[model samples]
Target: MAKLRTTFVCSNCGYSSPKWSGQCPGCREWNTMNEEVEEKTKVSAVSSVKSKTVFSSVSSVTEISTGDELRYNTGIGELDRVLGGGLVKGSVVLLSGDPGIGKSTLLMQACGTFSRDKTVLYVSGEESAKQLKLRAERLNVNSDKLFVMTETDVESICEYIKVNKPEVVMIDSIQTMNNAEIQSSPGSVTQVRECTNLLLRTGKSLDIPVIIVGHVNKDGAIAGPKVMEHIVDAVLYFEGERNYAYRILRAVKNRYGSTNEIGVFEMGDGGLSEVENPSQALLSERNVNVSGNCISCVMEGSRPILAEVQSLVCTSGYGNSRRMSTGFDFNRLSLILAVLEKRFGYRFSGMDTYLNIVGGLKLDEPAADLPVALALVSGFTDKPVPDDVVAIGEIGLSGEVRSVSRISARISEAARLGFTKCIVPRSCLKQIKTKADIEVIGVRNLHETIANVF
Candidate 1:
């Protein structure tokens, strides 16, 4: 056999180089280059074949046909909500999470629903057919229309799709699938890109929705080339500790619907069960009269969720005080501490502080800012915040309380959860016209909030 030419490729940024380099110039990372077999192609033979571009006249928006039915339900309400109603036909979705994060189980459960009326094909590249069967049996997913095949070759999977013509298809994982035409390995950039391209073409051409599972790196981002995320119609991430029973499904990108929507599920012995009332589930284990604990209402999409923010403040023995946060941004915590120290003259300089959001739910929005500040101050002063009170506002650098969006929804959720008092921004208070069952108090700054809460 003739010598097969090879080239060095950067695994991180997918930049190719003629020779080896200790550091990749593209991403400026050290020693990420790997040698891969380079397939030589005869370009002269195909140069004469010119592909003509076809153009069509643009039509009015009213003329466009959005069929009678645009989406199909996955039979799981929470999953359907996260998917922006239901799975859009001909739309490609990429689902990624850590190892054993119930990605496969969730997809399999959706498959069982799709197989009820529509033919569904599940192409697994990781697990064997028997292994899948046993797992399916354990999950109690039985459907005659659900077909399972264990294959890694992208070409073979395409062939199966063409022959079966299933209404919905799922690739167990994109990393495991490979295109024979690509000289690189299965999980390499070239193979993953080509395989996803093939699947995208197949799904679009057949008007079938395709769901591809992805692997996440140690940094909690989807593994493989960054372009993989851009090529898909939607990107869903599974979040929550593996040790915890609850899992959150959030959409980072969605072409058909809002990305703010989230799906809550509790991993049980049978399968994942949807948590209809997530706020209740999240605040069920709250201990009353705790010095460092405070309730906050944060809006997740259109849904209002009540979360517990806990803080611990103690005098630091070390020279440099340590600050730690779980399910909360560390930089945000530091900024809040700075505001408290500079504006209010409260010293957290010699203290070690820790913050945590209960139920493994991350507080990404600014609405939790005031509650976190309250929790921190409460911990430092060794005073318990009112148990029946829920805080909702954003803290500014000048120690002023700022208004948050969907303030009405947040207060309403807090009221429904049996909270008697709600502390909100003064600006947001004017927006509420009707009287709620709960007592609403508006504060202009953090000092007024501290006076009212403790």
Candidate 2:
């Protein structure tokens, strides 16, 4: 019998320390350190000699080989677009989202695509084989080459991967998988790190693409070490309200593709269907000729989308005024209010103001700035901005309209949505041309823009 070795590890950042501390210096998380004990096993002289030879033979540094472009197209347009054209062989992708956000459904379809042309393995620790089959049957997509396995042990999963040598392998969730070498639960810090490391090694060594689904924490981020995201090739985030049918797959980080790309998906009985023309869905809830509502053009990566910006302004009571916002940024709303007061001479400080973007999509693009500002002003003055008028441009502190990214795309989206007029930066005037259906209006400042519109 040998002595037991133990160490304290921080669950937040995977910080390891010899002794337990009240505050983790590594991650600054309070009281997150947990003690993990490992049993020591004595190795014979012959075993130590064999271990040195094995360790020396395992190469740590190797050249990264790029995957073929043809294999990157997975038949799913939105997914492929987000993945920077397609799946790269030997790449590890981590897709994380809140529970019940169709993480499983999306991966099922990805597996189904490869199983038709090549061998694919769909490994799940959360669901049974029968359950996965039921989902596949309901979706009317069941492939013979798509093998389903329910296991959480890392060693056995590695053995399965070695035996099958499939073209692609997907783990339903990396959170639930654990390595036998770690003395912790399936989703603990130790297990997650080790499981991810092993999978990454396997993917690189065997040249098989691995996509792992991850669970999100309460703060709406992946529930694991930050290293988990860095260790993988790409980090995909699945977002959208469960009540709403539309779901978005956004790539926050990618090694093989651009991070700005997003994949739009609509959930239905048949599973998730890709929205080819996503702009149409963003403006589907708008009502024509409505007061306090304006069509706003926003840039999604390089693409443009038209969304409805609604604002409600009313006199306040008691002592304080209220400011509330939905989908759009709250800080930007505050700046817009200041512009309305200083530039438009409208005293909105004493009023209750609420700004709303019709759909649940979150946007930070500067193109929505002018529309949001105008929507608030339109609500305050009780003036209905013309139904055909669309706003696009960024607003500055001096009430000057700033240039936005991809103005041409924004103007085109507004016109495609049947908006006759667009208020954009004067610099964009050169790029915008006269169209029969839509009229593009260029403005340089806030006063000139408001006076012309009013």
- The best candidate in terms of TM-score: 1
The TM-score between candidate 1 and the true structure equals 0.92
- For all candidates, the clash counts are 0, 1
Best by lDDT: 1
Worst 10 residues of 2 by lDDT: 218-227
Mind giving the per-residue lDDT tens digits that candidate 1 earns over 181-225?
Answer: 667777776677668878887887678999999887533112353
What are the per-residue Cα lDDT tens digits for candidate 2 across 154-182? Answer: 77887889887988889989878977766
lDDT of 1: 0.87
Q: What does candidate 1 score in Cα RMSD to the true structure?
A: 3.1
Query: What TM-scores do the predictions have?
Result: 0.92, 0.88
